[model samples]
Target: MSLKPNIVLVAALALSVAGCGKKEVDTLPPAPGPAPIQSQNQGSQTRIVPGSQADFSNRMAGLDTIYFDTDQFDIDDEDAVALRRQAEWLRQYPAKRARIEGYTDERGTREYNLALGERRATAARNYLVSLGIAENRLTVISYGKERPAVLDSTEAAWARNRRAVTLTID
Candidate 1:
């Protein structure tokens, strides 16, 4: 065979091999489609912002804020119902932790309110623990009368202020 023709054949063979490799790379199966939405969200899907206060509030709805009787740190039957609902929600998100913030009305002294608030928070934490929630996932803090839900000095406002608000934390 002529040297010139042999060289040309070799070059053509090399180019064909390169082209085959490119085709193989391009022919990979199409990337999998996005994962299917969970069956529970059959209609409209609502996106949840995990560990956000807004997310917690949205998921928890009316149960996030549990009101207490004046000068009381114990959880009442009504409060227990709300706490149960909250515990259910918390159980849904195992990765999430909760901060139980206790507050009191403006009637008590600051120090007394602080102590009462701590007791209230602890009370809520204990209730949640009793409801099968892990003790480690819950924390307690007392804001005393400092952070009032309602600013007015009415019975309604005080009633609203004396509460243990459960908030989701990262």
Candidate 2:
């Protein structure tokens, strides 16, 4: 009889001790923490320049630029077709944005080069806008003589450098 009582007491004590050691896990607090905001110009996600064959083939396909005479920002009749094609693409992809990067040959002072480059980019941008693209969707930057597509100091090289490039951005 004494053994039965003692066994019951021992089982009760074991159950009480096991219950004291257990705790309910918490899961709700960490999920409510704020997420970090990403900057607009974060480079990893920026679109690549469209001059490469793969990029050009995918986005511009048959479109190509018509070269300008030295120190000119005016888009001649030959250039209009290419600009129209670009505007069409922009219209088709309304969410897409582009940056117009302008460059110049190493013939002028740094400030002059910068200004000329800006004019070139602006002219191209304005042409696109005239074709019905939104001005807000485009950005213009002048690289001046800082970045050259062709590094040689030759006329052909200068001709290549004195151009504007379009880069798509998401």
Candidate 3:
């Protein structure tokens, strides 16, 4: 048996074995029936349609927004108080993980803004860690000036844009 013939035989055998194992994947079950839409009167609080509201409320409840002064990453006394409240919330829910997303206004260069945002997130994470939260349970990401909380260029909007947001994950 020459090497070339042997290689061809092996390849054929492998392909045959693979073909034997081929299976028809079941197509996804028919899409669920359309949900019944409910109508709400003008004066009433709109009731969320059941399953849709779960994710909305969960995301809403876990989101925490903290603002920062221009060109600053240090947690000032006022920010410290707010972070303490965030720490307390974490202490209340030991099993949850939180992500600190840092953002900045559009005043600086892209590279500088990214570094600033990262420092801002790290500053917040450090404070949480100092408050006895496990560093592993906290993650940080810097969006820089890319994802502004407010799009306007006014002072008020710029103030809103300089922020770190904490989002809880279970």
Candidate 4:
């Protein structure tokens, strides 16, 4: 009958309704199954089965690796073409991140090769960043002469080894 009682009723209704916005989660269903067991080694990686997206992407667009001249870290016109495609791919899949890995031929000292590898990787990363890719989504690493694409010391082998590879993150 009084306005004060109506106001109190409205306030009580509001208090009741305020908490209804967030529906409580149902009791979770039973586990699908026990988690798969792993070997004792238990590497740092969480996934035992790696993503095949990189392979699929590589098959679709050959933008995985860019070759470099001996003792050079500059991205050539040919490599630029691939890099542009890479930038496009990254743009399309904003969720996908990448790691630019630099590798050098086994010609220089370890220290020298490491420095060269770093420069090579950084060059690739910078080029991708210039193409409007978020810098935070990309990382650079140097493998030096440790992980060669080709093992032999021949000119052709060295040529294949001197390169930067873009590995996609899951």
Candidate 5:
């Protein structure tokens, strides 16, 4: 055998072995989504809208929002039905968290309605806490009349505006 050919073969083998030592690195993971929609009640579930996966999953599970009658912060029997579902879901997922957004009709003064909204949100949060949901997992915000569900002045519109919406967050 020619010594030159042996040398060439050895060089090729060395090059091929060197290439095998290099690893194929994976791409970086995806960035997280934006923060959840929180009501004005700053001090705040997992039913989500464009939040974490758990939050989104819970929202898809039907823990969206609960409504109340006009000028009422109290959770009525009908609303209680919805909250009970929310409580059960929260219990099922202890890692999940939520925000209670209180809203009101345009009938009241802006200041008054704001206070009412806070009260409504707090009522919902407190109810959730009473149901064994961790109080630390919940936050409350009052949008008051500023963010009405319905803008018209009719009774039906006002009734729709009087609500506390629960949103899932990270």
Candidate 6:
């Protein structure tokens, strides 16, 4: 057999394989604009623009960070309560989207910490979904040991470092 025929056959096979897997995507309705915010600045109303980082931060203060124990990815009761509040905030702003960033302490290998961080972020995201937040509105990223919240080597710093931070996004 000539090589030309083999080339054509291989090309056809390649084309067929390339199109074999197709994914069906879920669609969401248009998100409503941010609700107006009332402020006392000069006795005039202001807007934070819901779904924006500012809005999420403003509404999620003191509840945006979820800490984990050493070498653990589980969400404890305290974190669960915080996550519940975060979920409620998400529910109030249906159009808002969030990014869950996971981090680790400075004691683990980069690879290991990366995986652990991913688990942390995923756990937070899953908890939010279970609380009725739309799954599609959340995304996850892991900083692992690369981005420590505190640079100190103290246990308290490490505790703060091992956390997942939920940030609002457009």
For candidate 3, report its TM-score.
0.63
Tell me the number of clashing residue pairs for each predicted model: 0, 0, 0, 0, 11, 0
Better of 3 and 6 by TM-score: 6
Give the range where candidate 1 is weakest over 10 consecutive residues by summed lDDT.
Answer: 33-42
Q: What's the C-alpha lDDT at position 108 in model 6?
A: 77
Model 4 stretches with alpha carbons more than 4 Å out: 1-52
Using lDDT as the measure, the top candidate is 6
lDDT-better candidate, 2 vs 6: 6
Tally clashing residue pairs in candidate 2: 0
| Model 5: per-residue Cα lDDT over 61-103, one tens digit each | 6445667676678888777777888787777668888888899
Tell me each candidate's TM-score: 0.70, 0.64, 0.63, 0.67, 0.64, 0.71
- On TM-score, who's better, 4 or 6? 6
Model 1: per-residue lDDT, tens digit, 1-170? 57999999999999998877533465678787654322234366645455566666876778898888889888888899989988888888888899999999999799999999999999999999999999999999999999998999999999999999998887
lDDT of 2 by residue, 1-170 (tens): 47999999999999998888756777646555333232233464544443333454356654534355689888888678877877877887787787888889989899999999999889999999988899999999999899988899999989988887776667
> lDDT for model 2, on a 0 to 1 scale?
0.77
Q: TM-score rank, highest first?
A: 6, 1, 4, 2, 5, 3
- List the pairs of residues colliding in candidate 2: none
The local distance difference test score of each candidate is 0.87, 0.77, 0.80, 0.83, 0.78, 0.88
Question: Model 6 over residues 1-170: C-alpha lDDT tens digits?
Answer: 68999999999999999988978769878797666553223455565665566666687787899999999999999999889988988888798888999999999799999999999999999999999998999999999999888899999999999999998776
Error of 3 at 12 (Å): 81
Q: Between prediction 1 and prediction 6, which has the larger lDDT?
A: 6
